[model samples]
Target: MLTLACSWLGMQWVHEAGHVLGALATGGEVERVVLHPLSISRTDLRTNPRPLVVTWAGPAFGVLAPLILWGMARGFSLDSAYLFRFFAGFCCLANGAYIGLGSFDAVGDCGELLRNGAAMGELWLFGALSSASGLILWNGQGRHFGLGNNGQPVPFRHCAGLAAITVGLISAGNLFFGTG
Candidate 1:
């Protein structure tokens, strides 16, 4: 489950990074960012000029950043490109599901989206497109995780090392971002 852990943490970080970028783009001041491993991630803005853009940025960039990274990995012919691809797919699925599914429950960012003029149909469309893209990207990815011999295998040690490093970086970064 090391890989899953890393992917989860990385996804949260990237999603929040998107919000940070949006805030920066809109001249919003980030008052605090909560990204603890054990807590739900959120970005609190002190001065948000454009709430809709900031809210949308969280998931939009969350999915795009990893896709870009995966593209770069594939372009460079990295043997670990599958891992990056998997991460990208996972982000799309998670973020899409979070927003799409959240529409039904009317909570979290989706709630905020709706409150700020986002149509449920728009949320559904985003969810469907992103999750479908994730699934399409994940096709034929089984072999990378020691599944059928259809692709290059990723070593367990590398995954473990990645997990460790990810935890370290996120934990350290939180010191600067937590509750401020």
Candidate 2:
């Protein structure tokens, strides 16, 4: 459990760090990188027209650490391998969900940049998907876990709903394909 927790945390760090690196690469200055117990945020210069690129960079950046860890996990014992794979899969899914959801802000931010003569189509799509999925999840979850947002204790019903969905997906997958 400790290993799983550590792996989760490590993956999150790498994912968030990717956003920071992307911001820097695209001529945007990172204002602050805040690491809290439950989450991290890389606040950057809002004035930069390349916010979409920076936002897209975050999820892309996050994939690196998990892939590296997945490679390392392959050489481990069976039990450890299972744990590592689970961790890797969870990280990938969670990060993908996050990127897809959080990028909604990119549309508005990118629009502003576009007005200033910066054009980016791919970034726009990434941002739109992220934002749309994020909004849907937020609505369903009954809370907002978004950039600059703080953690809140989720309601029990909400937790249960999420668990049921996860279990249902796993059960359906196993029943149909004999695999998770």
Candidate 3:
């Protein structure tokens, strides 16, 4: 149980890091990165009129990190190594979705400068990336909706309960059903 908890925490760290690094690389300034068991809170620069490429980079990196880590872990393929990779992948996807979807708020706020009329390539890209991440999290943990784009404070108990239930189910399935 402890091992699983630690693994989940580690994965969450990596996931949040992915978002931070992506934002930094793309010239998006980070306001805060609040680490928690349930969610990672990040408030990035919304004032700048950044290029679509720059805006897209943060979430792109977030999605890519776990995939790369998972591939590396799979290469090792030792005892239960893949599970670690999966956890990391799930974290990356979830956090990536948050960053990607959350970018909309910024874009919407600076609509006059960044909107670019009807050309919505950046919007579509971010939305798609976030949606993909949400789907991955849903499949792995049965967590469907996150705190909305507003970044509301979700009760820690609720988030912890969901995570606990997910871990329990995964463990039980592995033990009784002999499936990993």
**Best of the candidates, lDDT:** 1
lDDT of each: 0.88, 0.50, 0.49
Q: Which stretches of candidate 1 lie over 4 Å from their true place?
A: 149-153
Encode model 1's per-residue lDDT on 5-117: one tens digit a residue. Answer: 78888898899999999999999999888887777889988999898899999999999999999999999998788889988999999999999999999788899899899
Screening candidate 2 with a backbone cut-off below 3 angstroms (N, C-alpha, C), the clashing residue pairs are: 15-62, 100-130, 101-130, 101-134, 104-131
lDDT of 2: 0.50
TM-score of each: 0.92, 0.48, 0.45
On the 0 to 100 scale, the lDDT of residue 168 in model 2 is: 55
lDDT of 2 by residue, 28-80 (tens): 77665544334443344544547656655566656556656666867664333
lDDT string, candidate 3, 11-96, tens digits: 54454465456556667676554444454333345533444444344445555665666667668874334344545545655544
- Residue 165's lDDT within candidate 3 is 54
Q: State the displacement of the C-alpha of residue 135, model 3, in Å, after optimal TM-score superposition.
A: 6.1
